[model samples]
Target: MDTDEQQAYRQLALSGATPMEIAQVAHLHGLGAIEIIRLLRSIFTLEFIEAKELATQAVYGMSLSDYQEKYLLPLFQEFEREGATAQDELLQSGDDRHL
Candidate 1:
């Protein structure tokens, strides 16, 4: 993905946009559904890893398992659910545009 596009996605996520909204904006910018999903996953994974690293380096360091259980797991699950919804929405929108 282009750095500018990735940054735009990150900004949208930070601003609390839903996955469908992010996907819509990405589509408008010429990204297909797969590219949008890949970009979103990449952004989310990078942020998750960064947060884990920070937590590990803190004075009160959190163990990997504890961090995963308390934070990563739940967030990942939520992401999966949102991602599926976004994919469906993107596909439907694409069909509508073609028709």
Candidate 2:
């Protein structure tokens, strides 16, 4: 970012704009929207982004260590058991992949 763009970011920051809003403006100006969102997220002391409108941008392909260490691991375990049960049933039905 140039001095002018940095000033724009600073102004947006001081105005207390949400991360998503900042990202939209940054996108319009051809800025790095992801970095802008991350910067604002830090400024706002966010744990997880709740902007459903930006859910794809908020967490798409995101592999935050905390998310896996806490939320996803537990959810994965729950689904793993269900998958195991389904696999057993499919095996009884003679799945060719197992053969």
Candidate 3:
């Protein structure tokens, strides 16, 4: 997705647009509906994860650096590593067929 699509998606999503509505707007912009859905899923997933972490920090009095070092950094690294592994597996499996 392009920057404009990202901005529009975030704005519409944060403003409480429905999934179908978001899909319509995204489709009008030549973006795929499935792509919009995936983007929304990713956005909300990150928000959910961050909210849980923030709540934990509030309960434990964890410092920003502590949170980063203990949770955020490791989680991000693991996600990246997992994505890379999945990509490698896909490549090795020769799964070029589109879903």
Candidate 4:
């Protein structure tokens, strides 16, 4: 049930007309200005979404906390139960026994 206005708007849009151009075409075809603006708004929204997806794909990395959790947290936890002095003494004793 597409009307003449809808067909005119679609043809103008598919030809990549600028917003002003589309409005002019709509005016010549006896459509309201608001109707042309509404169609342009939906097209802009779709383009924005597509550009955002491409940007996300182009760059990827972990946040600082993610890096710390993966690499630093385990090492810290292992030595955390033993105070610094105790850990150093244990290492020194092990070295002496090895010698």
In lDDT terms, which candidate is top? Answer: 1
Candidate 2: misplaced stretches above 4 Å? 37-99
The best candidate by TM-score is 1
Compute the lDDT for candidate 2.
Answer: 0.60
Query: lDDT for each of the candidates?
Result: 0.64, 0.60, 0.61, 0.52
Give the 10-residue window scoring lowest on summed lDDT in candidate 4.
51-60
| Model 1 ranges off by over 4 Å | 45-99
Structural similarity to truth (TM-score) of each candidate:
0.42, 0.36, 0.36, 0.32
RMSD of 1: 17.9
Deviation (Å) of 41 in candidate 2: 5.8
Residue-wise C-alpha lDDT for candidate 1, range 1-99, written one tens digit per residue: 778878988898899975556656766677654565576566565455443443343322455577678888999999999988887887877764522
Q: In model 3, what lDDT does residue 38 have? A: 58
**Model 4 CA deviation exceeding 4 Å by range:** 1-8, 46-99
Off by over 4 Å in 3: 45-99
For model 2, what is the error of residue 55's alpha carbon versus the real structure, in angstroms, after optimal superposition?
8.9
- Tell me how candidate 3 scores on lDDT: 0.61
What are the RMSD figures for all models against the true structure? 17.9, 8.4, 15.6, 17.1
Which prediction has more favorable TM-score, 2 or 4?
Answer: 2
lDDT of candidate 4 over 20-62, digit per residue (tens): 4554554555544344445545444545434333222222233
- TM-score of model 3 vs. true structure: 0.36
